[model samples]
Target chain A: MQQKLTVSQLTKYIKQLFSYDNLLSNVCVTGEISNFKLHSSGHMYFTLKDEHSVIKCVMFKTYNRRLRFKPEDGLKVIIRGYVSIYEAGGSYQLYPEYMEPDGLGDLYLAFEQLKQKLEREGLFSAEYKKRIPFLPARIGVITSPTGAVIRDIMNVLFRRFPNVVLKIFPVMVQGEGAGKQISRALDMINKARAADVIILARGGGSLEELWPFNEEILARSIFKSEIPVISAVGHETDFSISDFVADLRAPTPSAAAELVVPEKDALKRHIMDARIRLKRALAGKIQREKQFLAQLSKSPSLRHPLDKINQLRIDLEQLNKRIENAMERKLESAASRFSVAFGKMDALNPLNVLSRGYSIARSSGKKIIKSVSDVKKDDMIEITITDGSLMCSVTDVMPGT
Target chain B: MDEVKSFEDAVNQLEKIVELLEKGDIPLEESLELFQKGVALSNYCARKLDETEKKIIKLIEENGELKEENFGQEAQ
Candidate 1:
């Protein structure tokens, strides 16, 4: 008969057997997680299961700290670790050294999870985005020092805008500690206020290679940057968390360079166009003013000022002729009336009778014998004529029948 | 003109000059003055665009102070 053993002894023997087996010592198992619990002591206990089977798993604080994503209940995952028997519980379980999400990979799941977390925190809100400068005087680039990513960006930037000042802040694009290195560069650039805009650029790579950009620290750093950030990571298809948090996102490194500054040739063309428009506008204004002046010069009052003066002169001559005619008529009528009055006075005068040769005789004693009745004898007589005065005495009057 | 502050300001002034001239209500002497100013502004803007050279620099920390290093034609 075989010797019997205590429960603890049997369990320890099984644990020893498990430690010696290479397959059980280091193995990868796929299952769904359930009954997950994280103790305050930083130990994680969960059960991973599939449609057909389940396994109890434990990831300690040390290994749990390295997990990129949180494992939840019902989550299918692939764990890499050793299978060992718990001597006290008398059961076997999986002690996972590494855990990853099944099918989708841990990095992608972490990216999605962080993206969701930041989205809820409003880090990707449109209101938080800063406006990119239309003409940035200085552009800061955060990328690898030696690679086509930097070369491509430099070529594009220099070819497009020659006047821009480019400041390169070299950092590791992908690898261990790349995320922290990138975050530090961002902080340095922001602290110095060295550039108007920043370009966080990297060449295309696998999801694993581009993991640094998906870090939460880097996302927050890019969001908190004072300068506007342009995220250009991987190819067009790859969308990292930095791309969502940045002010703008470019498809490629070359594209980011193109977005930072305007093309010199395009600006030159714009200036030329503006110059031509200015000249045309000025020329049109001058032509309009010239036309206005020409219109004023053609006014009737300005053209025929002498015609009005000549008409006034003709009216003055007509007034002078009317006054002269009236004066001459009045003078002739007054002279005729004065001559009539003089003739009437002259007819009443006795001088005309004297010139007609009528005379009167008187006696020598100056008495006139009129009737031949009683007459004194001696009387002196005088005679008067129109041309000479005649004295007659006692002239006899003859009574006309 | 030396009082002009920037290329954009110069361009803005030129546009204003053109607008004032376009109104055609100003005196002849004033219009001529504005035209002369606009011409000068245009010349200044063109010269600013033409005279610039490509510049590349690196940011470095030295003795706990941020400094710049001129990257010459080698970068090109």
Candidate 2:
């Protein structure tokens, strides 16, 4: 016959055994998470399960605090922790020290997850990009105080622009606290309202050296900054989360400075060109008005004042010539008509009748002797012919019916 | 026309004046006014460009507050 152990005593023995086993103490478990829940006490209670078997797991608050992504049901994850038995409940459970997504390395997975998360939140959308100030009086630069970045930036900026202030906010470019330092610098620069535009820059390095720029905290800080940010992190090939979040991205810090300011000589030439254009435009306006005045002078009415009067005078002279010609025509017709009537009158003339060899007799009183008794008494008579007159004495008077 | 607030505004306004003049239909009086303002704005922008002294500064924390100083003079 076997003696039975109490439940607590048996569980305590199993917990001790789990702790002593090296493989059980430190193990790596990969599976899909299910029944995941975070307790109010900050412990994550979940079950890691494969196709046939499931393991109960609890990640205490301390370890979960380090997670870059929140664990959820149905998420495939690889966890590293100790497998220990809970003495009170008499069950074996995995106490995870670290948990990460299954497919990618820890940092890269964190970047991808944060990128997806922020992208879902619309941080990388085009509309969110701020317009960099034109001719910013103070340009804020965030980089290491001692590096080729700051010096190269200064050199490019000085070469391109002559009339602006460059304000550099130095921060550690890499390592554990670098993200925090950069985030803090952004806040401080924003708080003081020191700069109109900020350029966050660094040189090229391995993925780990550029890790700080990929941090979600730095990305969020850059997105939150009211001032426009230009991110110039690493070489052209290196892209960081800050590059996506910043308003502008430059291939290099030197390139950032070049883009940030207008070229001084080019600007001078621009101003000069505008001035020349102003002068030319004014001259053109004056010239156009002058031409207008000239055109006005050339208008028909004002051009030649005497032309209308001259035209009227010529018309009046032509009209007078026509009137004289009409009168001459009327006179010629009247004379011709008078001549014809005169010819008819000539035909009816009494003298012309006498010219036809006709004769007449007359007494002294010029009475004609037409019968024998017309001249019986003392009367003077005359005879008339076509060309002459004859006188005769008559002793009697003649009367006839 | 408003006050020339910055080099950008000044240049932008100058460009606008140039465009107006280019149309060549504006009255003489208005053209003259635009020309004068344009010239003045051009001069203002030039003077602004001239006034900037190739300045570089850095921020340092002296207690809890951030303040500015000349950029580290190592390379001048």
Candidate 3:
């Protein structure tokens, strides 16, 4: 009798078997893709099918993040991953770690490989890119001399910038030695120090013809140039390695020429505009100053200087009157007080009492006699009246009765 | 600016002066100086744009040495 096993138990056993098998643990499979699904989680799920059978495959977000081309249904690709059993789903699937387009040409493959390698090396980083000059004094162009590319560039450059200086380095833009010649041209341009900026340009061509721009040597040269390089290789849609590494990328040679120099008339107009503004600003400033001076002149204080003086004078007179009034009031109160004191002192004055018919009698020795007992008969005596003292002899002494 | 060396510098300075004066807060002495400087810059820029003719020169590699020649009229 066969031993009974649960579904999970069977799947786990098969998963262990697949894990243990070396051949299943490492695999590289090539087949047409089917049922490709890119989940929102960035995981890629697909099926690989041959004419006879199909195998389920899944590429996790980690593996698929490095893929240059998006994997699609019915596309042929080679995937490298281990065939593993998912115990939860009770199925075995191919877990692809790497994937590449199967039948794409070698040129594209090489391009992709180089781009990925250089990107990993950080050569195409935006931080490494130099800024194109706002306006270049001299523009150095590297391209085939005989082609319309040169003429178009010259036309644009001369038409836009009437006083522009252009330095063109003629080079072969195609075939075997083109990349080396362009590289040498870049070095020569840099060494000469003649150009404010350089433009490496070519017309639209087949990928074979335009391959020189995509060459690593030219790319590295453009990246290494101290002077900013503007790349205009092939058509607008065609992107090359030099385009990525150059300081700026233009769609065409004409566009590069147009970009390198500012239009002479526009610059003239800008200067003229600023000049006019300067004039107007100075004039306006002067006008404002004049208006401000006029306003100041019209101000009450400045307009009639004597009005302020007169107002101050009036205020001074009012203050003087107030002080005089206060002083007079104080003096009058003091005089009244003096008059009252004088009256009281006059009442206490002995001269006033004596002038009122009272007399002070004294002996000749100047002693006062208050009663008859103070003097004897036949004694000389003196009497003090209002105005004078009189000496008399007392005939008889009289008592108070 | 200490000196106006190139058309770009001169124009930049002129524009700055214009902006400064346009604010109307600068003293008269400085405004007069800026106006004089701006006039000089404008004249220099105009002369620079007018006096120089358009020149297109070509670099010919002769015996591994590069030399310059006028290239616009003759595309060689």
By TM-score, the best candidate is: 2
Relative to the real complex, the DockQ score for model 3 comes to 0.48
Clashes of each: 18, 17, 0
All models, RMSD in angstroms = 9.3, 7.3, 12.8
User: After superposing candidate 1, which stretches have Cα over 4 Å from the reference?
Assistant: A1-24, A39-41, A51-55, A84-93, A305-401, B1-53, B61-65, B72-76
DockQ of each: 0.41, 0.62, 0.48
TM-score of each: 0.70, 0.77, 0.73
Q: Select the stronger candidate by TM-score from 1 and 3.
A: 3
Candidate 2: which stretches are off by over 4 Å? Answer: A1-4, A298-401, B74-76
TM-score of chain A, all candidates: 0.70, 0.73, 0.72
Please report, as a residue range, the 10-residue window in candidate 2 chain A with the lowest summed lDDT.
A392-401
Model 1, CA-based lDDT: 0.83
The lDDT of each candidate is 0.83, 0.88, 0.86
CA shift of A301, model 3, Å:
0.9
DockQ of 2: 0.62
lDDT of 1 by residue, A1-401 (tens): 99999988888888999999999999999888999999999999998888887778889999999999988887888899999997777778999999999998888899888999999999999999998876678899988867788889998998887777888887889998999888878888898999999999999999889889999999989998999999999999999999999999999999999898878788777667667766776677778878988998899867888888888999888888888888988988988898898898777665675567655444555554354443433333555565665553444534446
Q: Find the candidate with the highest DockQ and give its number.
A: 2
In model 1, what is the error at residue A278, expressed in angstroms?
1.1
Instruction: Flag the better candidate by DockQ, 2 or 3.
Output: 2
